[model samples]
Structures are given as C-alpha cells and as structure tokens.
Target: MRSYGNKLFLFYIILTGSVLAVLGFVLGQLFPFYIVNYFSENNIDLDTDQIDYIKKQFAFIITFLLVVSFILICLINGKLIRNLLDPIENITQTARELTKGNYRSRAFAVGPANIVELRNSVNLLARNLQEIEKIREIENERLKTLIENMGSALIMIDREATVSIVNRQFLDGFQLDLDEVKDKNFLTLGLPKRIEEFIDHVFLTELPYRKQIEIEVNQEIQYKQIYGAPVVGEHGRWLGVVIVMHDISELIRLEQIRKDFVANVSHELRTPITSIKGFSETLLDGAFKDEKMLISFLDIIHQESNRLQMLIEDLLELSRLEQHGFSVKIMPTSLQEVLIRAVELTSPRLDEKNMQFNVDIARDVTVAGDFNRLIQIFTNLITNAITYSPENTTITLRIKKNDEYGIVEVEDEGMGIDKSEIARVFERFYRVDKARSRNSGGTGLGLAIVKHIIEAHYGKIQVNSTVGKGTCMIVYIPLRKKRN
Candidate 1:
C-alpha cells in the first residue's frame, strides 16, 4: 500500500510539473512577439541590448513562477491523494481482520463521499457478522446443554465412522470418558458388539434403523432400545449417523414377569379346580352311597377348595400392596410385640412340623409401621421357615437395633435356596421347590407381599442362604425416633 501511494504521488508531481513547463514555454514565446509589436505601436526605438535584457528578465520571471507553481501544486495534490487513500487503507485492514474472524473490527467512514460510503458498507457488514456470530454461539450453547442433560444415551458419528459427539448419558452408560470415546472409530471404541453392528448397518445403508438389543455389562444382562439414523444435510448430503440408546432392561423384565404371571395363575387355578371337580364327580357316581368313601372324597374336595381360596386371597393382597400410592399405617409400634404376635399366630404350624422357635430379643425396638402388617410380615417369614425346614430343626427369631433401623431376622435350618434363585424368590409365584410349596399349601405370594410391605415402610429386605446349609430372611425397618 505504501509503495502504491508513493507511485501515485510521483505520478501527480510529474504530471503537474509537465503542465507548468509547457505553459511557461508557450507564454515566453508569445511574450517576445507581443513585446516587439508593443514597441513598434508606441513609436519607440529599442536597441538590441535592451531587447535582449528584457527577454532575459522575462525568461527568469517565467522560470521562477513555474518552480513555485510546481511546488504549490505538489503540496496540495499530496494531501488530497493521502486523504483519498487512507480510508481505503483502513477499509482494507478491516477486511483483513474480518477474514481472520475478528467481526468487531470496523473501518473509519472518513475521506470523500464515495470512499466514506464504501467504508460504511464494510462496517455494516462487520456488525452483521458480529450479530450472526453471537446468535450462532447462543444456539450452540443451547444445543450443548440439551444434549448433555437428555435422559437417553446419544452418540454422533462422522462420515469417516469416527465418534464425533458423545453426551454425558452415553459416557456414563458405557462407563467411558470423553477422551476415551471421542475421535475414535465407532467400531474400535469397545462398544457392545450388537450396538456396533447396528451402527455399522445404519452407516452402510444410510437409513434409519431401530431394534431392541440384548447386551451384557459387568456380567449383568441389559436390554436396550436403540435407534440409529443417517444424518442428511442440504442437497441430500450424507453427513454421518446418529445413535440413541434407551435402557429398557426393567421394561423387558416386567414384560416377562407379566407373561409368567398369566401362565402361573392359569395353572394354579386349574389344579385346584380339577381336583374339586374330579372328587365331586366321583362322589356323584355312586361313591356317595358308601359313607367312608363319601367322607374321604368330601375331605379332599374341601382341602382343594380351601387351597384355592387361599390362593385367591393372596393374589388380592399382593395386588393391593403393589398398587400405586398404597401406603401402610405408620405409627410407633413395638418390634418385640409384633414378633411375639407373629410367633403365636404360627405356633400351631411350628408344632405340626415339630419345630422349635429360639426367640432372641436383643431389645424391644420400636419402628414406625402398621402393627398388623408387621405381624403379617413376620408370620409369613416364620410360616415359610417351617414349611421349608425339616422337623426337629430350630428356627431362630431375633430382633435387634442397628443405627437407624430395627432388624428382624428369621433364620432357619431349611433346604437352603440356590444363589441363582435367591433374586427371584420375591417374584410373584416364584418358588424354589414348586411341588413342595404346593403340597405345603403355600400360595407362593408370601415373599412378594412381604417385599411390598417392607418397601411401603421405606425399609428393605435381604436374603442370605447357602444351599444345603441354612437361609436367613433379614428385614430392616426404620426405627421410630424419640422426640427431644
């Protein structure tokens, strides 16, 4: 720019100097002719020396005036040219800054009207660019926040099949960090094989795909509902693929439970109904004529009817306990009293099995719960212990306080449950020994009802057992704290 300005200045000086020299030469030549005419017209005789001296003076005066005019013109033109170039120079610098992403830079609107207008246009462009950048930044922040907080795990892959964006849920779900996952190839990130295959399929087809896939994490099976789609931009440009995963393990488990419940209920009901029908039909077919046979058939029918009634009642109780917003009556109740009442209620069963209760009350712990529900919970536990244990085995009942909870444990020397079956014990109609439970007249919803009641009290239940050794049912209930 400086070089250009110098060249322009030089050009202006040369042009001005050339014009002054030409004018001076033409006036000097014309002055000689005009002076000679004037002298003749005045009737004055002039000598050659006088003519030569006057011509010398005239030539000197023209030379001095030309030099001064040249200097004056150069000075004025230099200022004028500088004024013209400075605004353009500023606009040029501003444009350079804009290209470098400095939207705040602006040119000065000085100099001639045309130059000023150009500078104004550049400034307006810069202002618009700055506003657009601000808007873009805000939108970017909003998108970032939404992705980070979304409930489902999300991953975005670029056209190169590289992980480009991973949200917090994705990182946490996969037990990964951003540095470990981002910029890595989608298949090489140690994702579940099923998930990787799904993503790969989407990328290859450039189409939307969805599936419920089973995956194992930390040795536990999980069910995920995954959705993948190819990202297409303007002009149908394939950008990449985006994958979203929703953890549906609970939903899948519930669905399985529902199916099992339906099958189990149908079977359980059919068994007792068939028994009642068969025994009654036998009696109707002249078996009632023999008093002994009639009594025997009637007894069998009565037992099955009782069993069926128990099953229906247990099912109703479980349904009620499992309902939403179901609450237990919470009041200060003595744990010792509840356990004693449960033991008394189940004493006839214990006696029938020839089992003895080894009661150990560490303290009369008080907990906030329904007294009747507490009795029900312990009665069911004790009854189960008797039903599963051999005769002459001692069932140990203990009540103790720990921290904020009153713990009641019903430990029995019984046919202990296998570790794999322990988790399903509380499931509706789940039984370790189905035939034994049916013969013992258990409805099989005892543990399920106990679990719901415990949860309603904001408490917990834990089972510990080793096959062929013993099983312990530990119930933890929050203690009723005394007010100061």
Candidate 2:
C-alpha cells in the first residue's frame, strides 16, 4: 500500500461506487412500484396480490446488479492508481541517478504508456553529453599529438613559476626529468642564473617575456629563443604561463645561406653578363672593321648565352620536379643508349679538362624509367666530375644489373667533396668549394637537378666522398614496377 495515491484511490472508489449504487437503488424502487401500482389500480381481476412477489424479486435482481457494477468501478480505480504511481516511481529513480553525475543515464516509460516529454528531455540531455564527450576526446588527442611531435620544446608553468606540464620531447631535448623537477622552485633549481632571474621577474609581474637562452647539449652549445605568454583561466584567473622554446640553429644557417647565395649569384652573373654586353657593345661600335674581332666577340657572346640558358633551364627543371603529383612513365630503356647520350653531351667538357672516359655499360642492364630524365641525370653527374677532376684523370661510368634492379655509378679522382659537406652537396646552390666552384664555371645546380630527377624516377642517388682523395656517385634503379 503506497501512501498518498493508494489512499486517495481507495477513497474515490468507495465514494463513487456508493453514490451510484444508491442512485440505482432509488430508481429501481420508485419505477418498479409505480409500474406495479398502475397495473393493480387499472386492471380488474389481474392477480394484483401475486404481482407484489414479482416486485420483490425484481428489486432483489436490481440490488445484485448494482453491487456487481460497484465492484467493477473499484477495479478500474485501482488500475488508475497503479498507473499514476508507477510513472512517479520511475521519474524519482532517474533523478537520483542524474544527481550522481550519471549524465548518460535515461528514464524509461512506465504505467500504461510512456510520457513523451519526460523521455524526450532525458534523451536530449544524454545525447548532448555524448556529443560533448566525443568532441572533447577528439580535441584532446589532436592537441596531445601536436605537442608530442612538434619540433619546438613546450613547457607550462604557473604564475609562481612552478612547472605544470613538460612534453616528453621538451624534456628529452633539454635533458630534464619531471619527477625530479616537479614542485621545485625554479629560482633555487640548477637552472642558469639568467633564466632564474627571468622566471622571478615573470612571477613578480605576472607578465610574459621572450629571451634568447643558450644551453650545452651533448657537448655542443645550442641556441634557442624562448617565448612565454600568460595563461588565463575562467573569470580572468591568472592560471599560469605557457613557454615555447624554438630552436633557431637551422634558421640561423638558412639566413647565412641566403646572404651568400645573393652575393654569389650577383658576382657570377655580373662577369658573364658584362662580357656579353661589352663584346656586343664593341661590335656595335664599328669593331666589325676587323673581321677577326667580330668573330672573337661572337664566340664569347655565344658562350655567355649558352651559360645563361643552362642556368635558367636548371632552375626551371628544379621547379617542375618539386611540384606535387609529378609522375614519370617507367619504360624499358637500354643503359648503353643512356650512357652514350650522356657521353656525347659531356664530350666538350671532358675534352676541355683533358680527362679520359671509360664506359662499361652491361649489355643486359636494361632499366625502366623516363629515358630523357635519366639522360639528364647522368649527363649532369658526368659533367660535374669532368669539371672538378684534374687533367688526364680517368672517369669511370659503370652500369650493371642484379636480380631485382639496375645500377649506375660515376667515379672520379677529383678535388673531392669534404665528408661534412657531402651530405648537403645535392642541396640547391650548394658548393663544397665556393671559390673553386665559381672558378670552374659551375652554376651550383647540376647535382641538385640529378638528385631530383633520380628521385622522380623512384631511384636513389648517393655520394661517397673524401676531401683530398676521390668521390663516387651511385644510382640504384628498379628494373620493373611491382604489381600493387
């Protein structure tokens, strides 16, 4: 027996059935008596005395039917009570779960049918919670991955300069341990004096500062620029500061490279362009008077034009190769044919350097690639060796075949690349000997072009060099494309 609803239901059933039963009884009494009295008074010899027994029997039947009707009403009242109470009980349970921060919990339908509004409200809340959690997870993962992989070191500190978070990359890059440094005062830690003072300044002012700090790592001094900003929380609360330490070693190197490239390009172009302009100007000024002078000027002009054209062509080729989605058709081509073309192109340079050429292209070393690009690649490498090597030095072009691939190599006993600069030799406009590179009439782009063209063919190019001894360039190329 539930308290309020059950008691109200019992009272309603009893009261409603009692009133209806009384009304039915009244009607049965008055109507039956009237009918019987009318019959008795109007009829003659109609057996009125026996009719009284009939009226009594009729009254008894009406009383029995009224009692049965009251019983049906009580049953219906009980059903209504149960239906109302069941829904209330379900809602109460759902509220209790919600209070426990079970945001995903939902209410169920109860009683005769589900209440649409209650179920919809609960469902809406759960859906909102699900969507919010999903978004939070995605955002958290994205940020975590970003921090873990970013090249710069990242650290977070409170306004009091207490470290809060230090990414693993930052920790390893700086040789720090979080367990050892956590909850420690930066000013008293083994940090450099300048950095400690900077931290103290930031904490006192609750502002940010960017400064250059130098640290020794692995016995080498490294330079970095550290930038900080105040981290604000809800209601303008000053939570902490976020610090980003950016390594500027590469940046500094690139800056120097840019300055050097400008000077080199200007100096190189000035001499040739000046020669071409001077010779043309002299010829225009009636220097054609001497047919010999005219011929000499024309020869110099042709050489200058060719040099300019070669440099421009190399620049354009590099630009084209760097573009994304660039593809080459890998077709079967004879290695001998490629070598012959490269030799034909470099015959002038080889003759100028007085170098001997020996080619041993395997008859069976047929490679699959863009034939024209491969020719350009080898032509550049051979020309470079011819330009760098001394007179009468033997340059070798060896081509061979394996079970899976073809190989081509250019070896020379030249003023070889330094071991340190060997790795960067293929970079754009890089020259191991800047002075010697200029004197040799190099545009400093030949090897870079070779590198890109080989890579585009899905081949690899490597260089082995010793500063005073010699150098070898190796190219590995696939014989055929594997089926995907």
Give the per-residue lDDT digits (tens) of candidate 2, residues 1-484: 2677778887998798779878877877787777777877987344656777777777788778778878888888888778777676666666677667676677775544356577667768777876887898899999989987887888777766677777776778757787866766555447555656666666667777889887666545567888777889999999887778888866866786678767766766787889899999999999989999899899989988887776777778777887898778779887778888999999988888788888776465777888898898888888788877889998999988777678888999899987667757876778887777766667888887788788888788888887766789999888865569
How would you encode candidate 1's per-residue C-alpha lDDT over 391-477 as one tens digit per residue?
Answer: 999999998888889999999999999877887899889999999998999988999999999999999999999888789999999
Deviation in Å, model 2, residue 462 alpha carbon: 3.9
Reference-based TM-score of each model: 0.67, 0.52
TM-score of 1: 0.67
The superposed Cα distance between candidate 1 and the true structure at residue 83, in angstroms, equals 15
For candidate 2, what is the lDDT? 0.78
How many clashes (backbone N, Cα, C below 3 Å) per candidate? 0, 0
Best model per lDDT: 1
**Residue 163 deviation, candidate 1, in Å?**
3.2
